[model samples]
Target: MRLSRAFIRAVSSPATVAWRSAQSRIFCSSPSDYRKSQPSMLKHLTSKIKATGPVSVAEYMREVLTNPVTGYYVRNNMLGPDGDFITSPEISQVFGELLGVWIISEWMAAGRPKQLQLVELGPGNGSLAADVLRVFGQLQSVLGGASVSLHLMEVSPALSDFQAQTLTGGGSQKADCEEDPVYRHGTTAAGLPVSWYRCLEDVPAGFSIFVAHEFFDSLPVHKFQRTEKGWREVLVDVDPEDSGKLRFVVSPGPTLASATLVQANERRDHIEVCAEGGVIIQQLARRILNDGGAVLIMDYGHDGTKTDTFRGFKDHQLHDVLLSPGSADLTADVDFSFLRRMAGGGVACLGPVTQGLFLKNMGIDTRMQVLLRNCHDPSTRKQLINSYDMLTNPTKMGERFLFFSLLHPSRLAAPTKPHGLKLEKRSPVLLPVAGFTDLSFS
Candidate 1:
């Protein structure tokens, strides 16, 4: 969820744009004016606002990102160097490798079911999945890799195609991919089977290992601002002075959101609540509770709800969210407290620990040193060092990003307390878990 600060740049100036235009004309044969290629989303949004008076933030985000016709995700290249932002998987293979190891360990802890489903939410370009699969392939001799299957929950068809290409060694024949009404199935480069579902509900019932890295942050959240009287739900509306412009407007009175405020008396005047996030958490909890498995959530957010975090990113730079609606990526910090509450009783919540501490305790430094020794190329070595630093540095992604775990109590089979999660104060035996060995729950 934490973007690489080094890669982040301020919005380009006029001179920079001129240089880009020249470069595009020279190096690129055909450059499409992205804005002109599609109908104006602003117009559509303005019309909606006119009809409805104002729209919820969630509605705006959902439509802006997934409008099917004019959505940002449908038209924009949203990952890697060419896109708006980069994910941890895109940063380095090491990140995904560690995650793969974690999944393997969790699988073993879950008793190594004969059939295990490895599910990833929002599998962008399938980079993480590829890396994880590589690890699984390497350990096939011991773990029986054939027992595992990869299931991805992806909505964008274009991104799905990109993921298919990446998983099948950068190029895949159209004939190899099969799609039905429910899901799409294919084989990876190493012949490992995979499937893509439109939603979590589509995945068949089974023992699952769920990974949601930077997934929940993108789900739209309702913003509420406190006034002297009470809280008012923020809404997006067309500016009165400038009809073409959009702005945030508070409701006339306190809305339904005030009922769920955790810190009503807190000095902070703003709060964000993602009802959709709650619903999805409930679904995940039910899936894992009924069918024994575990879930790993890695994102950037506070333990509780916060405010003024909803922002947009375009071309690796932060920008005015309303400037070019539906063009930039919008995301907010996840409230781990809300996730924990939605998990209910059957699922045990783990640490909402910083990603830096998790990686350090998991021996990222040791792994880096090992890789450094075998590397001959100076550039590759330098890149590795830089990525390592960026990932673990407190100022960068390390401290900003958080790691959380949810496990089914029955699957763990541990006589002692579970790892990472806060345990009863009087519990004498706390079982140590890898990567969480040093973590102490007070």
Candidate 2:
């Protein structure tokens, strides 16, 4: 299944979107405010604040993004030239193709698991999945007769429909009961089975390659600001001046999240902590430790150096984060350091390398030249060149986007045998993780 994660679709805002070339909701109302008429969401948020005396920014984000009926992500078709932003896979096939190679590289490094599960979180329109599958089909010999299946975790019904159509070519079915772990099932154009789940907890256990692109950024982050009185969590409150609007306010004293989520020796005056993101990372680490697979994440992020990256996007232009509830995309730069810490010591964590270096390491240059040689049309060639530039240009998506990974500890160490009191292993030369190091290509 495929859709555009093409170049940034919005007319502006480059720093916030690299996978968006770099990277809304409409409420039903009058033509001018249709996208802004998130009546249910607005009323719910205000009422909750009125009752609880304001809510944490994390709580606010959770409602605005994943609130089932009217959450921004739940109701909108917000990708492509028609939506707020576009993606790399939509810009060019090379992006996903290289990712596909990385997946295979990891699989091979893991000794080619008998059953290969390709699980993608929040696969918008399935464009990345489709591109990866195309590569899988082309490299059939490399894959041998291994069993391969696709698993996608997504929430938007509209985007799921797009994913089904894109991946299955109209050949898919919905689960008979809502209680089923898999809500939908189908076979790809390549005849590989595909299943859909609502959450990561529901995905069937197996050796799986988990990939999340621009997913972590959407997870709710608890914002905190240090004060003379100590750390105070940021809360969203009903605007005193305008009941219809919302505003950022600080908690009076340390709350549960501020007490625990923030580090004791932290130096930053302000911080955005995604406890939910940490929980997800822990789950992934647990899975990798138990099932022997890998997790590859690509997104707009930093190595814990950034502070206050939360912002909104609507129709591609920057939107006020608290202006219209459920009417825009809200995201923050992922803190890879936070993820690494949460991954714990059970599995090996790899680079949060710049997207450009990662792609170049994965042989993007060679792949580009190969594609360019096979094409003759001037316009297509120009488009290909532009797409290549979009992905690799240091100023664009390249420098802004990052690739981070989690792998089984065994991936780094040779197989060991249990001795009387300890484990013993032979010194085997293992291939370095793809994209993280040039040794992968070498």
Best by TM-score: 2
Error of 1 at 378 (Å): 0.9
Question: What range of 10 consecutive residues in model 1 has the weakest lDDT sum?
Answer: 9-18
lDDT of 2 by residue, 129-161 (tens): 999998889878778899999999987777899
TM-score for predicted model 1 compared with the true structure: 0.83
Error of 2 at 373 (Å): 1.0
List residue ranges in candidate 2 displaced over 4 A. Answer: 1-38, 414-432, 435-442
lDDT, residue 373, candidate 1: 81
Model 1, range 1-442, lDDT digits (tens) per residue? Answer: 1112121111101111111111111111111222433348888888977765566677778778878888887766699999889988898888887787677666766767787789999898899999888878875753664378889898887888888888875544333434453456788867777878877878889988899999899987777777665665666766665666777766655444444433556566787766667777878888888887788888989877466788889989986676677778999999888788767777888778888877766657767877888899999999999999889899999889998888887644563333333322211122123542221111
TM-score of model 2 (CA atoms): 0.86
In model 2, the worst 10-residue window by lDDT is 18-27
What RMSD, rounded to one decimal, does every model reach? 11.1, 10.2
* lDDT scores of the candidates, listed in order: 0.71, 0.78
